[model samples]
Target chain A: MTSVLEIRNLHVSVADKPILKGVNLLVKQGEVHALMGPNGTGKSTLAYTLMGHPLYVVTGGQVIFKGVDLLELAPDERSRLGLFLAFQYPVAIPGVSVANFLRTALNARRRAANPADKGIPIPEFRKLLKAKMDMLQVSHDFAGRYLNDGFSGGEKKRAEILQMATLDPEIAVLDETDSGLDIDALRIVAEGVNKLAGPNMGALVITHYQRILNYIKPNVVHIMLGGQIVESGEADLALHLEERGYDWVREKYQEKAEA
Target chain B: MSEQVAELEKLSEYKYGFSDNVHYAYQSQRGLNAGVVRTLSGMKGEPQWMLDFRLKALDIFNKKPMPTWGGKISLDLDEITYYTRPSEKTESSWDDVPADIKNTFDKLGIPEAERKFLAGVGAQYESEMVYHSVQKHLEELGVIFLSSDDGLRQYPELFREHFGKVVPPTDNKFAACNSAVWSGGSFVYVPKGVHVEMPLQAYFRLNAEGTGQFERTLIIVDEGAQVHYVEGCTAPTYSRDSFHSGVIEIIVKKGARCRYTTIQNWSTNVYNLVTQRAVVHEGATMEWVDANLGSQLTMKYPSCYLVGEGAHGEILSMAFAGPGQHQDTGGKVVHGAPNTTSKITSKSISRAGGRTSYRGLLKVYKGATGSKSSVVCDALLIDDKSRSDTYPVIEIDENEVTIGHEASVSKVGEEQLFYLMSRGIPKDQAEGLVVAGFIEPLVKELPMEYAVELNRLVQLQMEGSVG
Candidate 1:
């Protein structure tokens, strides 16, 4: 099957300091891929580069999403192309309610899919929003609050999942959604991701812990070190890495680099 | 940045720059003197006391040199026409107003707003109020809403008692100028125990060039009464600069509450200098929601004198300065009675080489024990060339008082922009949302229509900032 997202020899830097060096990855439809790595291994850098963050310079690479080259697009264009990133730390946008933000995102995606689309009606938008919130057990009051303003860590994570659910992106890159979440929140977020996983969508869950995968049940797992993938295995790879830590992976990558 | 500069060049095109083709019944010669003041008062056929008051104010205005402390406003007094009255009489009904004058208010959606939400409406064209009306039910409830001139003619006792009490002619240069030639403003009096649920609105429009608009507004909320008054001002863009110096005085009697909201969107050629003040009586509350979005230069500070024990005052100010515009505005509160409190929140945004400043004063008197005051001023600069400044003075003569102040100046955060854009919002829209959020505290306090207009103006200011 053709992959939903293909990243080849991805190289990215920030302020002249190279962070993502020659990374390669692929995500197929309906498949959940887990990216595990230690701290400072540039996991979040890869996610940001994939989302076309301006600060993360794409020195050399090609990111193909649904036969379209993502590097040539703006961040909003990338998002309109069904690429979504569940940020580990979502920025607080005061005065913009969550419902309004979701409606805008949904409208942008609809307009992108068909230029003639006039966007969704308000009543229908509210209904869809309520349905999504109910699916994740989010409170109705969350829709009225400012976008992530004064939200707790778990609330921010839940809001991110809520956005993924509402936008219904083709491929989602969730960067460390598990960090800072309590057990109940982790389960709920993982369940949200699992419920959204189907033939029409793919997910790349970047995390440092094996705990989230226990609930997510990733189809494939990859360990990253030194800005490159060091090993690929089944979901068990996450458990092994969590138990043994990343020293072995670092050693293997060092030896490979020397060779 | 080059694209932004190109966009800034297009900013000179004003949206409301259409001149109305009409002849004025009375247009003062373009200068100021005792004769001009006499001419204005004599035209209105004022009583002897009012004419004397006008002459006294004119002398004060002549003696008081232009203020040197605020934004640099290069208004040539000789070039400005002191008065321009389009209509000979203030009409109580829209049908009696001239068609040309009515068309301007129609274009501004004033009648529609009045129908939907306002209990009364006052539409000022040039120098005089061409139309003024209050709902019959509100009138029957003893609510008095009329033109300042009509208020003096009809309710002379009430008008004379509160006209210059809050903001006297000697307060400042602009106040003296406004007192000398004031016309076309709203005078609302809500009687005791009566609450006007809907807002009383006043719309001021300047159509003629080289003219100065001086409107005096007086509002008295009687004991146990409540009211909300909203005023909006705009002028057609002109090559020769115009001047606007108005005075607004309000009195919140004991156990009353009053909210005054002003949305000023004048053309860039106008210098807007105004003084607004209110006195909060025992257990009364007064709120000032002031938004300044346009003008070549603006220097306004709405103040409240908490004269009665346990009174409360609040000021929520929002200022937006675009290219070639300077907005210097803030709030002042004087706590003169025991247990009084006041709060001031100011938010400002500047872009495309514009400047914004927050200059506020908070004074707690010696006899006022247990008084509290807090002031917060936050400014956002969209580009490096834009500027913002904060000057807050808090003087405490009493030892038993709590005072707090916080000020911050910030640029639009790159991370926040990315966070919004990652969710499919365009760069310009994202920036607009950030700005709207920055002033959300103040905008939320405005009426619904004003809030919507404020957001649209913010979006217009944020246009072309993204490359």
Candidate 2:
């Protein structure tokens, strides 16, 4: 079976800053991969470069998502290839209701991938949104509000999960979804993500703390140091890092990178 | 002035021939002067007071010259005919109206529109109204709906009292011209504590080229009375130039509410220069909904005066300028009383080398404490050849007042279009939807039919649009 996400020797930069020097990672189908790193270790930068943000430039390497060249596509084009990005700081678009925006996005993706089948009608789309809201334990009034306007940290993260469940993208790059949430809210978000994640959907969970991993146990743990992952292990590394901290990995990887 | 001039006038006749088709028994000669005012008054057989009003306005008109602020004003009053009436007698019965005049209105769906929803209907053909009527129930409530000519006849004292009160003859040059040559328009008066539930509409159809239409409308809503007046105009496409300079004056008495809507879609040859003003008394409200779609050059700014305590004003206007057009439109509000409020939102779209401008004003008087006003001007330039401008002025004399003004001019971003097209909406549909979304806040304030028609017109104007 093909891997859902494959990033080989990925080198990316931002404004002459070397964020991701050389990173290699692969998550197979039906798996959750958690990349744990300290500040300025290129964890979130990898997510943006993978999702094809306009500002991030991929200097070298290839990103193959389900046997397709993800680097050659635009942000929206990458989205059409069933790739989703849950930003740490979601942008707000005032006067655009959440319901209307999501419907437009979903219809656009559908029309790009399949031409004969058009967008969902208004009533049917409303029904789908209502059911998704109920499943996510979100209030119906949330649909009427502008997209992420004045939303709380927890609400914004949960809204991301709600969008995830709606679009059902093949690969979701969760960029620090647990960064701003409290422990309980983080658990709730992890539970929502776990429920939405399945055999067909692969998730790349990017985070700094190890608490979210307690709720969401990843199939593999990748340790990022100095803009690249220097160590790969099973979920035990998450527990080890939680007990020993990132200095151990950082010092060890610094020596190995120099060698 | 010369024999060749007379022969040349005879040779280059009207491109649009509605003047000759809709015949009248009594009419004034071409051009304007003090003698023409007396001639037009004599033709109408108006009383002495009406004749005096016209003579005073003629003096003011002769003293004032054309405005110099705007760009490329092509008004030639010397070559323009000041008065041309379509009928001698105003008909109470619709059947009594002439066949050609009725057919002209029939094409515009006036009869069906009146039957479906209208509190009153007044149709003006050329310089005189050929048809005017009000519902019986409204008449029973002492609601007066009549043409300005009949208003001058029947309500002479009331007409003289409020005539040119809101906008004086010295307000501007074209205003004085309109006051002097103004013939037929709608007159509305609602008694205290009564509300007119339906829309009172006045349709001005100009069918004659080289003929100038100067219609003056006055509306008075008594205390606690509410009314909505809708006015629409259209002129047949003509090669030769036509003139339309209307003056609308509205008075919302203490605690009364009134909304005046004007939709002007004249042909490209018509110079649409109108002056609309309204005064709101204590605890009253006034609203102006203006939509300008077609004209060679339109310089119109509806003004509102908040005179009494707690008066409110809202001006929602939109302008669309296509090829060879200049839509110079906006609004103004003056808060005179305490706790008054006002809002002005102007949206413009220009393409095909056309120009759209927002020139607005907001003023708060010295004693008007706790006053608030906001002015937002947004212009969308669809191509490089088009132009858009905004000039907003805000004056606050009181300590406790809030004023905000915002202006933005931007082209349609390619990234937005690409995003929409990626979603499967065709390029044109995507562009249309984005444009509609840009103006959604204003369109939602309009009536349903008008909103839909405006959207359709926006899309049609952008047809075959290319960078």
Candidate 3:
């Protein structure tokens, strides 16, 4: 089966500082890949680089999604091509209401997909948005407020998942969506992801804790240290890392790298 | 009278020079002076009191040198055409207004707007008001809606008491000039406890070449009255620099709530210098929503004097300066009474070598306790050549007051641009979106049509900007 995404010998930098060195990653369709990395490692940098964040420059490497080279494309083009990324620390944009923003994004996506698409009619669009909000357990009032302005941590996380459900990107890069979420919020956000997941969708969930993985139950767990993944296994790897901590893995990776 | 040599020269630069051919018995010859002032007053058949006021203002206008404290005004008094009346006289009905002048307002979408939404409408064409009227109920409610000149004529006692009282004639050169040569503006008096459900609107257009619009608008919201008045202006772009030195004064009597909004998109060749001030009495609230789009150089700072305890004032301003334009605008708030409050938020976007400045002042009097003021000014520079500056002065004499101010100038961050573009917005559109979002507070204050036009003007400024 063709992989949903292919990253070959990825070398990236954050603010001129060398971070991800020769990192190779791949995720198959219908699968969830968990990335567990230590603090100060290149976890978020890798995720941002994949999304083509200008701050994270790709010095050397190629990111191929389906058949297209992702590095050559812009973020919105990638987004239109069914790529959505929920940031670890999402940006808060004041004055842009969630309803208007979602409408613009969804309409832009629909227009790109169907040449003659008129975009969603207002009544139908509101109805569809209402049904999705019901599934996510979010209030209808959230739509009218400024996009993520003055929202609490748990609310922001749920809002991110709400966007993910709305956009329905093909390959989503969840950059620590679990961060700052309480247990209830974690389960709710995870439930949103599970409900949206399907055969055509692939997800790369980057996290530091085993708590979120308990709900999503990833197909594969990759442990990252010193900017590159050195070990890969089933979901059990997360439980082991959670129990033993990242220090043991770090020490063993250093020993093996030296050898 | 000092000659308007600059005004005549600028009017001479107006290339279209399209005269719709309206015959008039009298008009000011090409520029301003005591002769022009006397001619204008006599043309209106004014009483001696008004004539004396105009003469006093004319003397002060000549004596008061141009403001040197702030922006470069450089207005050549010689070039300004003091008066350019498009119609023979002001009219009281839409049908009575002349066709040539009617066509101008028709193209600008005023009559249709009045029929659809406004409670009343005032249209000023060149130097005089062409039409002024209100819905029947408002007129029956004792709301006196008339032209400023007519107001002075009809209710001289009322006009004399409040006129230039809030923003005195001695305030500045432009105010004195507006006081002396003031022609047509709105005269609104909301009676006590009456809340105007619909917004009253005034449309000021400078269609004539090389002219100065010295419209003096006076609004007095009596005790506990609530009113929202919106004003908008536009001019055909010309090569010669015209002048707009208008004065707007609002007196929110004790316990009244008044909101004065202005969306100004004058032509590029107009040098806009306006003096707008409001005095809020006990428990009164005043708000100013200002948006500036077109001008060669604009120096306008809408201010509020909180003279009564528990009074409050707010100003939200948005400015977009493109090539060959300088938007030197901001706000001022004076907390004169105990427990008074004020808030000022200014947003500016400069592109294509355009310049924008936030020149503001916030003051708390010596004995005003528990006064609070906050000023936030943010500027977004689209490219390298554009410039944004902040000059804020905050004086707090009371130790119990809470005053905070923040100002920052930021070029569009590459990360923000990339994040937006990665979402599929093109580079130029992305920059425009950031700017639109940056000034969203002010944009949200505009009416729908004006908001759309503001966005389009910002987009135009963004054209060929992103490399």
User: Model 1 compared with the native: what TM-score?
Assistant: 0.90
Interface RMSD for candidates 1 onward, in order = 1.1, 4.5, 2.1
CA shift of B366, model 1, Å: 0.5
Model 1 DockQ vs. reference: 0.78
| Among all candidates shown, the one with the greatest TM-score | 1
TM-score of each: 0.90, 0.76, 0.85
Task: Name the regions of candidate 1 deviating beyond 4 angstroms.
Answer: A1-3, A113-118, A256-259, B1-24, B88-133, B204-212, B233-241, B464-467
Best by lDDT: 1
Candidate 1 lDDT tens digits, B81-149: 677653532212333222333343344445443321111112333233332234465678999887788
Which pairs clash in model 1? none
Q: By TM-score, is 1 or 3 better? A: 1
DockQ of each: 0.78, 0.13, 0.41
Ranking by DockQ: 1, 3, 2
TM-score of 2: 0.76
Ranking by TM-score: 1, 3, 2
Every model's TM-score on chain B: 0.84, 0.83, 0.84
